[model samples]
Every structure is written in structure tokens, then in C-alpha cells.
Target chain A: MLKNLLMALFVVMQGAAFAEIAVIVHPSQGAAISQDDISRVFMGRSGDIAGETFIPVNLADSHPAKAHFDQAVLGRSSSQIKAYWSRLVFTGKGTPPKEVGSDSEVLTLVAKNPNIIGYVPLSMVDDSVRVVATF
Target chain B: MQCTKFVWVPALFVASTVSAVDFQYGGFLTVGAGTIIDKKESAYDYEGFNCPCFISDFNTAGLYERGDIGWKQDTRLGLQGTVRFQPGLSLTAQGVARGSDSSVNLEWLYLSYDLTNEITLQVGRKRIPLYYYSDFQDVGLAYIWARPTQALYGWEASNYNGASVRYATFSGHWEIQASAFAGNETVRKSGFARIYDEVNQDIRWRNILGADLEVTRDWFTARVVYLQSDNSITDKPDSADFSRPADKQRVFGLALNADFNDWLILSEFNTNTRKSRDEELSIPAPAMSVGVGRRIGAWTPFINYARFWEKSKDADYENERFIDLSATLRYDITSSSAFKFQINRFSDRSEFQFVGATTLLSANYNLVF
Candidate 1:
């Protein structure tokens, strides 16, 4: 009885957790990209995507969406990711995606920049940016 | 270099009253004490306590405490960038001084240039790719009570000066990354003894040149490190070589790490060999360490066994072994800081000339801006 109860709770709780993040871009973006391409864009570690000049934008460190984006999209801890990026930044070898604040801010920026890709909460979804992937 | 200025710099000023990038920092501090349980006697004169905490000082020849224990501090303060920088280019650096060192040496300075989709060209004086912990061994960031046995197999200088080129390939469930480095190495050792007015005693091995490589794939990472130096080490024994040509020495190491979710296992074996007449006259030294750790939520507990052996034509030459352990727990109170605590034990088997066996225990509080 206890095992079944625990399993039910686990399943119910899993439903509440998000599985993927929506990678949004300005409505102006017409590029038909791939899944691997999307991962590269968000990791900020990628140099190019499908030959198109695209830039990945990150949410501010403290934003709630940042957590969803990290686990659902980036698949890393905030600390591990930062350690990963500092290795690039301090050396002048690479720059990560641009960072913006708030779901509304990211949506507005994506709605405006054709080459920009960002993430936001599902509720904030709108016509300004397209959902590139569930994650 | 064109859009070089901080892109996130303006975001801080435009946002709220307190900017994340403005740099606010604080850290926790913990101290502890412990006792030496066992020892073998040698005229070398040294300490052999295996408590890994930073608090205990001065190596006692060979003394054991019945239930000996004391304060432990794994405390650290740091600065973390909150605004977040662009992916292609960024700037970062850190300074830490939690132990006996007077100040935090410049830990990392480099330019990470993404050459292609998979290759990253990082050039500058960053941590030498010696072993896994070689990268984040700082007390402020390292989550382990003590570094893994494979990384600190021996008492080796932790950092190197040089540029590293790293490449990585990622697929669905698998990932691979490799790094190679070319850099200058520096190390120091010093001691003094006095005889009658006409006689004086001094001994030391001050510095060297080194390089190392690391490669990793899903669940496994391997590393090799080499350090070479001439007798030109910064300090020389006063009674010895005033003009004697410096001798050459090499430290070679190899290790592997395996991670299966919350449980991670690691092993390392290394040997330090010196090639010079002076070395032969002194001793052939080699060291090894093996350790394992597990992560539970924000807390992790680990244990390691290490030994450093030195051989000279002289028999009763001193060889020492150390046992270390600690439980480290951290709860990320926020994005820039975390609360941490550590318990440790250090011990030595034989007291070699001047090198005594002692024990230490500590707790650490760390803060990052």
C-alpha cells in the first residue's frame, strides 16, 4: 500500500515539473531549424547554427524561468554552467548568450530581434516569439 | 574584440537599485582540531596527523591523541557574476585565501574563443589540466570535504601558467571533451638549521615547469600530468650548491573518474621521479591517492587514502601515508552563495627527517558575489 501511494505521488509530482522549455525568437525569424541546432544555440557554447547567424539569449540569473530553462533546456546546474562559461569568458575566448530580465523582457526582445532566441514561462507565450522546442 | 565591452554591464545599471554585477560578497568560516593516532620514528623529524581540516598547525614528530579532535573551517568567500555574459565572449576571475596562504593567487585568466561548433580555444594562464579537481579545487567552490584522491595524489603545486585548447562533441546521450595545455609551472620548498657558528643547514625545492592533459566522455574522464624542472628552483641550500648546476626532475600522473548519477567513484596513480645526481643523493619520491564520494541533495560525504614514499640509498629513509575524510553539505541559499560545512582527518605513518605527523579538522563557510 505504501509503495503504491509513493509511486502515485511521484507520478503526480512529475506531471507538475516541466520537461522542455520553449526557445522563442522574434516572429520575424523564418528559419526552419533542427533539435541539435537548438541545443547549440542555448548552450551559448556554440559558434554557429545551420549556417545562420543566430545568438542565444539567457535569462537573468535569479529569474524563475532561468531554472526551468536550465533543467529543461540546458541540462545543467546554474553553478556548473557558470563554471563552464567562466572558462570561456575570462579568457576572451567566447561570449555566452545575452541575458535579459523577466518573461516580458525576453519576449519583447525576441519579438524584436530576428536573430535572437530566448526562453520564457509557458503562460507568457505570445505571437512575438515562436516555440523552437518544448525544452 | 569589437563588441568587447560588457554587454551585461548596462543591464545592471538599467534594472534595479541593487545590481547583481556590482559585486557583493560574503563567505562562511569553520575551524577544527584533531589528534595523531599512529607513527613510526625516523630522525627526519616530522608530523603525521591525517586530519584534512585546515586548523591544526605545526607538525608534531609522532604523537597520537586518544580521542583527539578539534574546530574545522572549510569557509570561503567569493564573487559570482549574476547579470550573465554573452555566450561567445566573457570575462571572469577569482581570488581565494582560506588556508595558510597570505592571499588568493590569480586562479584563472583566459580568453575562450569558440573556433568552431565543437572546438574552444582558451588561451591564458588558467588552472593547468592536471586532474579533475585541478579545475575547481578552490575551497570556495569545490563541493568535496577534501579533493578527490586522484587529483591530489601527492603534495603537488595546484596551478600552472599557460594556455589550453579544449574541444567537445555532444550527441543525444553521450558527450566528449578533451583539453591539452602548454604552461610554466612554479613550486617552492624551504627550511633552515644551524650548527656551531661555522656550520649552517638548509634544504629546499622551490620551483619547476609543468603541463598536463585531460579527456572525458559520458561518465568517464582521464588525465595525465608532467612537471619538469632544473636545479634552478627559487631557493637553494645555503651550505650546498652556490653555483652547482640545477638538476632535472619529472612528475608523471594518470587517473580516471567514473560517475553514475548520485554516486561517483574515482582512482588515481602518480609517480614523481627526479633525474639528477642531487636527486639520487637525496631520494626517489613517488606518491599515490585513491578516493570516493557520494552526493545527497546539497550534501556530499567522501573518503580518501594517500601515500607519499621517498627513497634514498639511505635505509631508514622516511615514507609516509595519510588517511583523509570529510562530510560536506551545501544548500544553495541563493544563486551567488551557498552554506557549507566540512569534517576531516589527516595522519602520517612515519616521521621522516623534519617532516612530522599531525591531525587537523575544519568547517568552511563560503560566499560568492
Candidate 2:
């Protein structure tokens, strides 16, 4: 029984292995994105990146992938983010990243806007939205 | 007042007209009704006492409908706007009714500038930032509770008109913010006081000052805050009462929040006091409380317990302790709106004291732009 439980735990741990949030852009767009720049983009703390401007888009709050990105990337929850932006919003300091719907939808939108950067499941990666940086 | 109302129109219309400006303005009006059985004590006719703090005075001024049997839901319509002008500069403004009772009052207004790569500054009228929820005390989007602990931020000087600066990731996964402010030091005035001021004098107040700090990491966020306020008086229209001195009050607070995958943990505490040195005149009362909140799927159910104990030094303190148990439920109606409802039961114990235990139920829809 102990060995079986250990095996089950191992499976669960494997399922929860580290993952990355792929900051994606239109495949045709010519923008070099570094990993650190991607984190700054989604967090909305970035002022300027490269010569071209950056527009960060977020998955809808209710989307499951959003939770994954928050845990695997931003390392927080929707409530924490809301509390965070509340401090910013109430004081006129920071604006949260704009939210879009679905992984595929984010891919489509980012694929169309040169300035746009969004995150999606690795499975959805295609020429439509170029993976700028993974994680 | 008309000018005050107009300033919002052009601003609202400007964003509304913008074809696509990450701006979406929304809010809701709710009607809540419920009955509560006092688990503690009963009411008293203290309104007729010699001290004479009128029923309307300690009544519900700038407060919700007792959140009990009446329209306890502080139904309100609010507007919030976000404008992005440059990479490091943005502006946001929010305003809401103090309650179903107060006339329109400005809630928040500020302009922010991100200086350097890690520091940001804001100037204008804003929440005092004295608690985790101070910045969004009345805004309903940040949590699962109908309201954060009143003990955590119930002081009269919890809001302010001034400036604040924030340093985020100055070193690592931590951020710190501080603010200083001054605003009208208005007190809990009775009807008689209002009458005296309207008929005999001007309604002016002294400047108040305060500040707060917050830091966060991968899985945790913490905060501490303090505020001091000068006292004001409602002098008699006809009397030899040379009585109008500054009343000094200080409030200190702390809160911690942690999240792990599907589980969450949160706790907050506060202590507030009012008095003058020499014991000239003093509320001399200090109060504090703690609470916990969690989330589950699309529906996040939460429970919180709080206690309010007023010192006996001042007659008003009453040596009374207030205990409250509350539950809240939330469901997302759309990507941009949510429906929330809450139920709270209150208990108060102190011989001959006012403010007793009551039960209240309320609900509202929250939307944003």
C-alpha cells in the first residue's frame, strides 16, 4: 500500500511539474523578446521594450489557464492580483493588463496585433502567434 | 455641487467616446432584506439619556442600512475609468455613493506617474491606504467578504486627500508604499450640531495626517498602516463654551495573505485609540479584530469572525465588546460582472450601552469599466 501511494504521489507530482507561460506575438512581427521582458510585459510594469511599443493581454479572470499562468509565471492568485491592482487603482498608480478570452482567442488576437503579447497553452502554439519566450 | 457633478460628465464622455480605450464603466443597485435573532443582548432607550447623543447622531450617517432587516444593501452606482497615455504613465478614477443614504460623494481621484524603473507616485484625493483593503474599502471586486473588518479600518480618518509613493521590486519580490494626507476632520456630529453650524457658523475642519506600507512575495503579501487626526468640535450657537480643541487619534494595522494552488489563508489585525495627553478629553478607547477568507471554484464561500472591544476610560467606550459572524457567496455572472450576497449577525454586551447585536442580509452586483 505504501509503495502504491508513493507511486500515486509521484504521478501527481509529475503532473504538477514546472511549466512556462509562452509570451506570444504575430509570427510575421519582427520583435525580439527576452524572458525577463516577457515577465515585465504581462505584469504591466514594463515602460518600453525594444523600439516598438508593447501591449500585454491577459487571459480572462475565470479562465483556468489564467490560474496556470498565475501559478507557473506571475506566482499569485486572482484575488491577490485584484488586491494588488486595488492598491494601484485606488491610488492611480498601475493599470492591470487587459483581459482577453480563451487560449485560442488570445492566440488569434496576438497573431493579428504586432504590438500585442499574450500567453496560451503550449499546444496552441502555431505560426499564427509566434512564441516570443517560453516561461 | 453642480460643478462637482459636471467635472465627472466630460471625463466620462471623453472615455465613452473613445472608440477603444480599455475602459468599461459598470455598477449595480441592490435591495437586500433579512431578519436576525440576537445571540447577545437587546436594545435600550439610551437616546433619551442625559448625555443626549441623539438617535440620529449615532444613527446611520454615511453608513449602510444597518445591513439587517431594512435595505441593508448599500446599493450604489459607480464609474471607474482607465487611461493609458504613455508606457510608464496611466490614470484611473473611481467614485461611489457612501451608502444608499449619503448623497453623491467623491470616493477616489488620483493621477499616477511611474518614475524611474521601480518607483511610482500618486497625488490627489484617495483612500488612506491604512489596511490591506483600505485602498478598495468600499469597492466590491477584490474579495469574497461583504466588508473587511470595521475594526481593521473603522477610524474616522481612514480616507484622505493627499499623495502616496510606491517602490516595487526595488530589491526582489517585495513592494513598499507610503502616503501622507490632510482632509476635513469631521466628527460624528448629531442633528443638533448640524443645526448649530448651519444657523450660526461655518463648517470648516483642520488638516489630518497619516501613512501605510505593503510588501509581497511569491506566495505571500503583508501590510501595515497608521493615521493621525486632529479633533473638531460642534460649538453651541449660543453659549460660553470655548471648546474646540484638536482631538488626536492613532490607528495601527497589520494583515497577511497566502495562496497555494486551490487553497488560501488570510488574517488581519488592528488597534486604534483617541485622546489628548493630560487626559483633558479622551475617547481613550482602543479596538482590534482578525478574519480569514478562502476560495472554491467559480463559487467562493467565505466566513469571518471579528470582535470590537472599547475601553472604559471614556464613557463612550462603554466597556462593551462587539462580536460578529459573517458569511459571503460570490458567482461570476459574466466576464465583467459578479453577483455577491452576504449575511452578518452582530452581538453587543455592555450594561446600558447603545449599538446592540443584530442580524443583516445584503447582496449586490459589481461591475467595472
**What range of 10 consecutive residues in model 1 chain B has the weakest lDDT sum?**
B189-198
lDDT tens string, model 2, B140-225?
A: 66565655655444543444566667666534435454545556533333322332233332222346566666676556777777
Q: What TM-score goes with each of the models?
A: 0.68, 0.71
Cα misplacement distance, residue B6 of candidate 1 (Å): 7.5
For all candidates, state DockQ relative to the true structure: 0.20, 0.19
Q: Which stretches of candidate 1 lie over 4 Å from their true place?
A: A1-20, A28-40, A76-97, B1-6, B9-94, B97-99, B107-126, B146-156, B159-211, B231-243, B279-286, B310-316, B325-332, B351-359
Top DockQ model: 1
- Model 2: clashing residue pairs? B24-B369, B25-B369, B231-B247
Tell me the deviation in Å of residue B91 in model 2: 5.4
Q: Count the backbone clashes (under 3 Å) in each candidate.
A: 84, 3
Q: Comparing chain B with the reference, what is the TM-score for each candidate? A: 0.63, 0.73
